[model samples]
Target: MRGKSAKYILKVDDDMWLNFDVLLRILKTGAIRFSLGGKCNYGQYPFRDPKNKYYVSYSDYPMSIYPPFCSGTAYVADSDVIKQILTISPNIPFFRLEDIYIALCLRKLRYEITNIPGFHSTKIYPLACLYKSPMVITSHGVSASELRNIYQASCDKDGSMYVPKNPQQLPERMILEQRWPKGKLARKSFKYEQQLLKHNLF
Candidate 1:
């Protein structure tokens, strides 16, 4: 897995809305080799559900080390480290809670797993904050509606403090924003091209 390529792994929760353009810019800086997405505590885990057959916690096993936080999202290590882990533990037992298990394994191997701040959500006014935060992770606790509200609001002109565009141009603008932020006109045109391709309008 150790090879020279320009790529970064981001594990995002299903409910999380990432500004891909912003993320791409961050990746371009090359300061971060691996990144993990913050969790939004909206979904239920198998361990929490009473119906699950395989559910175990650190409390059950005294020797097991519990992760500092639940791992809804995490960054994969660089290719070399990834290869080492794969080679060393190719046939590890399949855990229902793979996120925490992976974190524990990485920690045991002396890999640093960082928690990104400002990437989370709260019950207050704005559902999400789109700040240029040094920390890159955030979570929302058990509020799917809030997540959707934040997403929609972020895409709205009047509602969103970030990327506010007219409703008619919102979709195209969003696509453009994801692709290229510096070249506004080019991004808009590129968005049109993308729409044509998606709808076979060409």
Candidate 2:
């Protein structure tokens, strides 16, 4: 389809869910050669396990370290890179890793892969709120219904719209922090302590 002259092309897997708002925001920044939705692999090795879904046989790829590639869940590529891939693909040996295959083509063309935050490839459940940010691009392992739910939640303007980066801080803590003013928090804590003492619970 890229040959038809599309300026940009976004490719995603069936299980991968995308936040179009965030994607548009990134593209507006300009000159993006390649942007993957999830974590970027710098020096990843080939999957050696024959039983693994991503396993690569020695006949396919003999290289010890793969060229830096974007996670296959989702990625956006500029037309130039697409053309480059189409031009060089026949010359390169076929590999099962589609993402790496594209990456190898880019490497040969001397193009760098760009990174956009919030494009997750992990199986971890996604937080509904983070979609408001331009950084959050893709989430893997989401069902069709859940994708709609996430899109609706992304439109929410309440303080409940943040995605927690640290697992240690629970949602309750976040709510408390956002819901109360600094002075009010201190006073509220003090009053709670007083009530505890009055009840002889302290």
Candidate 3:
């Protein structure tokens, strides 16, 4: 990371949905430079059950509460912070939770973790109305087709595909199917939207 020319590093999971335009806009504002992501498991206790995937033995981590850490789904760290973490990692005992481990390293260096509300840790519906907001940064549980639909809806200029955020602003159970285009797989994507509308799921 120290050898890289980029001043900041953005680490993202393959499953997460990212809006590069919005992220760039945020960076341009200079509000977030060091480290920023959704903070989760702030004071969570280490898993004790051996069957659990996150189980941590006393030898690995004797501490009960984990330090506040950002969700590993997606996060941005300054280049210097990345280099510092690598330099000190060998001394600090390894932990299964990489995010928590990184937080511990930051704590040792006396760096603050910046939490962004835009970074959701859980799955979120890629609704067109939500994406229109410049504050919306990342969403989880996004498929290829859903990503296409959301991006298209965001770029719509005719106002035909505009959906209101409030249910009261539109008709009851009225779905603007035209806004959500069925790209490569027509039926599969359309049916998924129909099911979502039927269940009022978002």
Per-residue lDDT tens digits for candidate 2, residues 69-147, read: 8888888878767877899989887766789988888788888887666566753334455444454567677677656
| Candidate 3 Cα outliers beyond 4 Å, as residue runs | 1-3, 154-202
| The best candidate in terms of TM-score | 2
Tens digits of per-residue lDDT for model 1 on 1-202? 1236635445566654444545555456654455333432323333633566656754553443355433554342345455545665655544556676565455456665544333444311122333222222333332466455444432332233332233234344432232333466656567544543342210
Q: What is the lDDT of residue 84 in candidate 2?
A: 78
Write model 3 residue lDDT over 90-133, tens digit each, in one string: 98877768888888898888777787756766555555555544
Evaluated against the true structure, the overall lDDT of model 1 is 0.43
| Ten-residue region with minimum lDDT total, candidate 3 | 169-178
Task: Point to the candidate with the largest lDDT.
Answer: 3
The window of 10 residues in a row where model 1 has the poorest summed lDDT is: 123-132
* TM-score, per-candidate, Cα-based: 0.46, 0.71, 0.70
What's the distance in Å from true for residue 102, model 1? Answer: 1.0
